[model samples]
Target: MSLSQQQELRAILEKGLPHAAQPYLLIAQALNTTEAQVLAQIQLWQEDSLIKRFGLVVKHRKLGFKANAMVVWNIADEQVDDVAAQLSSCSEVSLCYRRPRRLPDWPYNLFCMIHGTDREIVTAQIDAMVKKFSLSYVEKDILFSFKAYKQQGARYTKQGI
Candidate 1:
């Protein structure tokens, strides 16, 4: 409701989600506001792009997803959008995005990360995606990850973002 309260909300969000069944409800109660208000504020922040990224960073290995591959694709400039959209829609795909290709070296522009329980599972998922979507990639590489680094959400300081 007030500037101080909004900063408090941001602080809570930056520390990562509350480990509760109804995390939002807890936050709203603490702010002496309704759950809807809290959600609305978050929505407004997202719409305004106040936060660059607001999503859970799942520890795939801890969840038994041992296999993960970053599928690098050199998709056609014209068809990349459609292909990326389709890839993003797949449940198997955890992340999909486009990056500028570095010519004379790295040529892949489109990227998607697929996770599974095993190497075979991840490989099959990639193969299935290529077949199911008929992704006519000029070049494709399945870069299986050998290691995973720590993942954390954005940090909201007392000064606020």
Candidate 2:
């Protein structure tokens, strides 16, 4: 989808997903199109990679995950796949990704975030992950959020704020 289309869909999502009275119908009303057309367009957007995912944005802290930390790992270059597989399998991990390591200043390459009710629990989980993977070189750090200014999806459209 072009920037304009993405922006339009995002604008609608910002308002909220359609209600049960008429899900697609409501979206269609907002977009000034038929419900079927909206559904087909959304499906196409998804299939074509214009939309990565569409779902509820749950608040982790509200659900008791009060402690969240970014776990950066310096896995053996050869074992990145193995490590990422293990990390992704863990339910506590909410996000994981692989990126190039900036050595000397930043040695960790693979990043995974774990959420828990408290810092201690999160630390314990990280320890378990380390021991389970037998990753001796992996360095773990707990990054607590001191403040949250903007925690929401990206605004696809650039409307005057």
CA lDDT, candidate 2, residue 1: 41
The segments of candidate 2 whose C-alpha lies over 4 angstroms from its true place after superposition are 1-7, 18-20, 49-53, 156-161
lDDT by residue for model 1 (1-161), tens: 77777888988887777899999999999888889999989988988999666677778789998888999999888888998999999999888999999998998999999888999988888888888988654589999888868566546576434
Model number with the top lDDT: 1
| Distance from true location, Cα of 134 in model 1, Å | 1.8
Which tens-of-lDDT digit does each residue in 57-160 have in candidate 2?
87777787778788888777898888899999999888899999897898878898887788888888888888887865666566776555666756645551
* TM-score of decoy 1: 0.75
Q: How far is candidate 2 from the true structure (C-alpha RMSD, Å)?
A: 3.1
TM-score for each predicted model, relative to the true structure = 0.75, 0.79
**The 10-residue segment with the lowest total lDDT in model 2:** 152-161
lDDT of model number 1: 0.86
Highest TM-score scorer = 2
